[model samples]
Target: MAELTTLARPYAKAVFDAAKDQDAIDLWDQALAFAAQVAANEQVKVILAKPGLAEQRKAQLLADCFEEQLPEALSNFLSILAENNRLALLPAISELFSLYRADLERTVKMQVSTAFEMTAEQQQKLIDALSRKLERKVELESSVDQSLIGGVVIRTGDLVIDASVRGKLAKMANAVGS
Candidate 1:
């Protein structure tokens, strides 16, 4: 994971710089998403690892796949990855690129996990609470986890609020142990 991040960092920075300069953040995001999807596929991974395949052929395949959707700059970026045999890092590159974009936009992503599925009202309430706490607009991604028993666990980047029953129990146990 560390190596992947190391390999992806420069590419992500370059893409971010280009996107910012051209005012094409959305275009770069879409292209990166497509490239990431391609990289995640087993067949594409196999093809990318094949030493027999020419760099031009790989780039052509990428171009053909994204002909209508990708802009020229994004397509050329994909070609650069293919030439350097760095296509496998597309997913990591996309992740890093998203982080950079979020930094630029002053937005944060929050993961909210609850014991049960939340209704629209519940979700909105959580979002409102998080926005008030974080003092920023929060983009929430929610999930259901029966293991939580009750309450919710909210994670925003490195910070986590584990309010679940299980977490509470664990905390109590730790206190007793200490």
Candidate 2:
């Protein structure tokens, strides 16, 4: 995981820069996502791993897999990856590129897990508060886990706020132990 991130950073940055210059952030996002999906398939992974497969074949196969949906520029980008034998890094590159896109758009993704469904008003209020607190456009994602018993667990990037009943119980147990 770390090695893939290290190897993919430059490529992702380069693609992001190109997208910025072209005013095509969302366009590149869609293209990279499509390419990443192709690269992640089991049969495609096997094909990419074959040393005997020529670069042309690999590029063609990927382009065909996308049903030629790739723009000319992205098609060329795929050729570059093929030439550099970095096709396997597409998934990491896509993930990193999305981070770049989010940063450029001044957006942060937040996830909330709760024991019960959050009302639309409550979700909106939380999003509003989080936007003000984080100083970024908040994209709220949420799920319900009945085992949470009550309250919520919120996560954004590396930060987590564990306010669930289970979390409180664990903290209480720790305090008693201490």
Per-residue CA lDDT of candidate 2, range 1-178, in tens?
9999999999999999999999998889988898899899999999999999998789889898775577888889889999999999999999999999989889999999999999999999999998999899999999999998999999987899999999999999999999
Clashing pairs in 1: none
Q: Which portions of model 1 show Cα errors greater than 4 Å?
A: 67-70
Question: In candidate 1, residue 17 scores what lDDT?
Answer: 97
lDDT, model 2, position 46? 97
Q: What is each predicted model's overall lDDT from 0 to 1? A: 0.87, 0.92
Question: Best candidate, TM-score-wise?
Answer: 2
lDDT of 1: 0.87
Error of 2 at 45 (Å): 1.0
Put down candidate 1 lDDT per residue, 46-85, tens digits, no spaces. Answer: 8878899997688777667765856678778878988898
